[model samples]
Target: FGTDTANQVEEALKSFKQANVQTLVLDLRDNGGGYLTAATDILDLFFSSDEVIYQMKEKNSAAKKYYASTDSKYEFVNGYILVNGNTASASELTAGALQSEKGYQLVGTTTYGKGSAQTQKTLSDGSVLKYTYAKWMIPNGTCINGKGLTPDIEVENVSLDGISTKDVKETLKVDCVNTRIKSMQKMLNILGYSADREDGYFSVATQDALKKFEADNDLTVDGEYSQNDKQMMIARMMIYINNHENDKQYEYLMKIIK
Candidate 1:
């Protein structure tokens, strides 16, 4: 990661330490991934020193393993991780590492299962060379490329008439009453949006929260939550939970609701 992302994570961890959070749930659903170094650095925040976090092997090259160098400063007694089919690459790496190494509970569906490592190089002809040069494995020694790691507890997503909640554009707006609304509100609350209640009622507060999420994500500002907006909201919530699971308000909502 760059300075900006690292600085933001440090700020969040500082706030979490100040809050004295004990339990945390890191959500990795729909996270495609970024820099591998960034993922490993974040994993370092949870693991003890001398634990192997990742192993990499390139073509005809010896495998190299990376270990945690320091004990986790902000340790938690109970830690959970959430994942889904859209979680891939470095996201999958982090999830697998925590599950296999630290015994973190994984909840939700199977991950996207991308395990190869790629690198980009500028050639002498000014063209770029980008290709898969290696593959990575978690502490368990299993490479999650095509075969994804299953969750310890699989929680099905709420749906209506065989349609997922994120696809139901009409019934997901303000004042809607459905079982899936609770999931929507829970996600909103997890993302630091003011979804007042999780009683399956898309109330005014929920609508306002949806509006704020849309506005912040560069979507059309409206109370009506479209399918795209709902998906984006879920993605953003996953990112937020992955980064700020120890935030006081997020932990409070997680204990009170889902």
Candidate 2:
């Protein structure tokens, strides 16, 4: 969220209205969150001016509710928010408000619980110190601190093993046991090659899968993982994700929407 995020969303809604689009899917996955005003501004686009968007509680103070300040610009018969583990703070705030206020269902994994708000102060030496001063809650008054909001429709994307080519520092071959091998194994599985196992062990089946990947991509058909192989595998992984061939979350969303 930023100063321009609400403006950008408003512009996009205008396009959607012109195209006669009634259903909406707001994807907030991996959004670490930003300006609280931006979140409220975007929420105003969908909520009535009198509705409560969220609530905040300061130390030793009563909870204060924030109401929508603007009339809705668009109203859809159905809407869904996509969230994941990285959806935190203001993003979580937006998702939780939409879920609680509008009855909009959330689709995907649990959010990154971040209910606390912080303020910064500059010291005499000009250094800045940030500290939590308040906690924010959803419209229904649930403070999602360490316990994140669970989705109404839970779905997960295909695993990427959370490793990349940069993480592979050494060549990997048969009988070697490492996280890099597990990453390569997962990638191979997603790319339609069977690596047999994904336990960080470079078994014979894993070597065969690597060789097949190399042969298919016109690289040298060696049963070993090298720097070039790592690069090529990463490229193929990107292509797979870009093509949305393994987007299980999206697939489930479409199934329910249809």
| Tens digits of per-residue lDDT for model 2, 17-41 | 8999978999898899999999999
Backbone clash total, candidate 1: 0
lDDT of 1 by residue, 1-258 (tens): 433554566677778778996677777877887788877887777677778889998889878888876786456667778787888888888889988977887787788889998999999999998999999998767889888778887765422122234465463677778766777777777667878997888788888888898888898887776777768876775565456444433344365445
> Which regions in candidate 2 have their CA more than 4 angstroms from the true location?
none
Candidate 2 has a TM-score of: 0.93
| Least accurate 10 contiguous residues by lDDT in model 2 | 159-168
Cα-based TM-score, every candidate: 0.60, 0.93
> How many backbone clashes does every candidate have?
0, 0
The regions of model 1 sitting more than 4 angstroms off are 1-3, 158-258
Candidate 1 lDDT score relative to the true structure: 0.75
Taken over the whole model, the C-alpha lDDT of each candidate is 0.75, 0.88
Best by TM-score: 2
